[model samples]
Target: MSTFGDLFRVHTYGESHCKSVGCIIDGCPPGLKLTEEDIQVQLSRRRPGQSDLTTARSEFDTVHLQSGTEHNVTLGTPIGLLVHNKDQRPHDYAETDLYPRPSHADYTYLAKYGIKASSGGGRASARETIGRVAAGAIAEKYLKEAAGVEIVAFVASVGKVELPFAQGEDEVLGKEFVELLRTTTREQVDKELTRCPHRETSDKIADAIRSAKSREDSLGGTIICVIRNCPLGLGEPAFDKLEAVLAHAMLSIPSTKAFEIGSGFRGTQFLGSQHNDPFVDGVDARTGQKRLRTSTNWSGGSQGGISNGEDVYFRVGFKPPATISQQQNTAKYDGSTGVLETKGRHDPCVLPRAIPIVETMAALVIMDMFLKQNARSSAASLLEPVDHLPPSMILPGKNKVVETQLVEDKVVQE
Candidate 1:
């Protein structure tokens, strides 16, 4: 249950107050360049104490590569990584001993395991995502080298503050929003402490976070991620669709409340005629030949549960961090009533630090799907072409997936 992925497996371990928190990556392709610093970059982004809006907990989150490398080259074996929890203060969570801490995992974890960690939230803490972020950095390196895939995520909103252009006319498919998805980089996102690329919106989000922090409360918002240059056909049909797996991966993040791809909930209001992504003729950069691409990307680069070689985008909604410093009247483990106030450093708004975590999780999902599709395509390539099927069913020539679409269109016209 602690592990994820099929071809690129990752198993995470440790807890918030544990001695260390890290992961073991199994099935990493061999002979790729890797180092502690490569992984450390993303870890530092996710670490607390980066700004006043985030948790005050001071953690360097320095990563150590324990195994599975030879002189910076992966040995095609399970990679082991570790990051010591140097600044842990277990005594800060002593309040959880009596009360369950409403909206926190204290009560349910005890009900399920019959006992819970005496300090911190244990596996439920955002600290658990450290291992995921580390493993994702490795997968992301391989994907970029092997497929030229680029994944980027940014804080799209904080409470009521959002980028005005994103919600402009024509919905998310507007020219400006599309260009933003296509061009915004991690550096641009990191320009603000809120991780929002829009300067004015970022300032507003920061102020809202400070307001909540001053009140000893927390706020929640959304994150938008884009994956470009994804290979076609990277999902399993009938189940585990590309979007489905993406939803699973995103919802697993602590406090994440919702996941939606492409047009998301906004597209629901559009009729099929308005929402459909019409196929258009385009030139492939690699081959200098005509290719089929969607005129609009409302499908988020996936169609019929498979990638369509277009930019994939999605939004994830995170709930307010459950552990706030404010006092609350709640029930204890024994069902008794009491006033419980949480201790320890906590974030008023997690959107900023959560940026890298979101990008890494997306990288992990894409890496797994890419490997699965690669195997399927490799095996299919060895088979002789089948010519008996109708033109609508059989692609006209090697990689002429558009021919099948044209034939289907003719049938509909008839």
Candidate 2:
């Protein structure tokens, strides 16, 4: 379960308080323009101490490419990415060894392995997500260049405060919102420390998080992520549906408690006649071709477990961070009652930091599924004479996609 994906697989390693943390990404296509700079954009967003809303711990979090690329280009081999731990304070978590924090992974991990790392909840800490964010940035870059795919995630809610645009029904992701959601820049989200796009709600969320930090308590919230311009037919049937895989990715984030895709649970309030997406046929505005679209996207761009060329959107509910620095009644490993006061640098509201993590994870899912779908749909192009090639493979003066196949004109006479 630690490893993910079929084509663009990434295996992460290291613990929270370890000397370093990193991931090895296999199956990345050759000839991609990859560098530490490409990966750092997302890492910087996920970094701790970006603002007062997140944890104050600082590691610089500078990534160093260990392998799989030369001259800043991918080799189609395994890419090794690492970020060394610089400011780990294991002594701060020494007491956690004697008593497992309530609602934290200490007890479950110990039960599974009969032993656990004693510092910063080991691999269970949000620090473990650093590697995930790095790998995701790579996936996102490849997807963007290959298919013009765009991934965006924003803090939808902090406690009871929610962004007006992303709130309401989960299935409300539509053409109207795609443009609006796409308008939400990282700069706008960063304007307020809460990372909620709405200015008013962002302030409320910030105040709530600060209040929790003051009380030594924690707050939980939700994030809404969207995948734009995803190609059609990327998903497996039955168990591996696109929506199902998306749910799997979101729920995998630390402290995530629930997952919903398009219309989600709220759609149940409507009848079948109201919830169904009616097909609308039209001419393409860009390609000048015929196109079929759903008038409404209650299916969230997925139907029968596969994408239908619409924007895929969903929401993930994150629970309160389990590592609150407050005294609570809890049991020790010896099965005795004790007052446990967890200590360490932790985020009061995990939703803000979870945004980049969510974006990267979504990129991983889309990148993997797109590769799988491309294999099946690229057959007609094979063995055909190429008029144009990918920018990396094309000669000078060729940048557009070549669709005009070579045709032989020979007249036969009897």
Candidate 3:
């Protein structure tokens, strides 16, 4: 489906070669001081031709707020957005009519719909993500204002070139990685063309991408995203688990092939004792109140399908882009074999520009989950006090003083 979310609905429209690409963001709270520039910040990052390492397709991707805003403020209605495609060359993809490019969506889309877009990979193109990025920016703004939530993503690896922290044993959750998650910002990420924070590693990744581009080939990589200060109890149990929904969202991206949260595959090597996150006494920064926290985040800030108020982090793996300029012998729609040469601009490695898309998609998932939890908590607040219940069902320090009184009252009533 083109639409995503329950409370915060986002319906994306248009395609790669379409006149415009954008989204309609429904359920945004009113009075959010939104403007085209606010959304442009992210769109610019995801746009093509940012550097030689990316696609050569030149596009400013200038966005226009079509509706759902007045005087630069959201009206609590469905926010409509649009970004015109100025550099489109549908003729560049004319060869696709003969051959269904290998590893591409050409065959599947046609098989499912009986017809596919004739140019630029159509909805399968990265251009489709422009709408997601726009909508995510809005959700992120609301999250930042309401909960002080911060979301940051960085390229973790490119064709075996990985950050030192990710390469070391037990370092996936080490102090250095945790600190990076705590302090890394978009400015730091954009400092390098590869979007990898480490200078030396970023340079190595650049070389790897350049090597692939020289051969008309492509490289695959991974991205790590961290969501700081995410509210607790944001997951839906029995079905839409936090990590499960996150996987669904991340994997929906164009090239994303794998998704993992916290210890991920590495946890498989450890015994239960080593992987379990131990509860520890801590203080809430916002309220300076006592709270329970985990000594380790092997659960990725989610346990029992609910956020634990810890920094939530995950990694998404992207396959080498299926579209390359190289020639290949493959079967066409008619089951005929021939040499097919692909044309058009495409990233040899998508990790860099994909950073914002990853961050924004995470924002969308978090925003939707936050709203679901908010509604549940709001409804629960109106109910009678737990002063009528047992201490076992109540939080450690909350409503403790009423336990004895409630027990005595129960005995008298009996």
lDDT of 1 by residue, 1-414 (tens): 899999999999999999999999998999899999999999999999999999999999999999999999999999999999999999999988888888888888998999988888999999999999999999899888877788999898899988663455446456666777889999999888899997888889999999999999999999999998777677888789999999999999999999999989888877888889898888543334467888888999999888888888999999999999888988877788889889889999889999999999999998998777666555555566565566666443454222222122212221
**Total clashing pairs for each candidate:** 0, 2, 0
Number of the candidate with higher TM-score, 1 or 2:
1
Q: Which candidate is the best by lDDT?
A: 3
lDDT of 2 at 90: 92
lDDT, ranked from best to worst: 3, 1, 2
Instruction: Give all TM-scores, in the order shown.
Output: 0.94, 0.88, 0.94
Per-residue lDDT of candidate 3, residues 227-336 (tens digit) = 98887778888789999899999999999999999878977777788788999999754445577889888888889877888889999999999999888989878998
- Enumerate residue pairs that collide in model 1: none
Q: Give the TM-score of candidate 1.
A: 0.94
Return the lDDT, model 3, position 80. 91
The runs of at least 3 residues in candidate 1 whose Cα sits more than 4 Å from the true structure, single-residue gaps closed, are 165-173, 285-289, 399-414
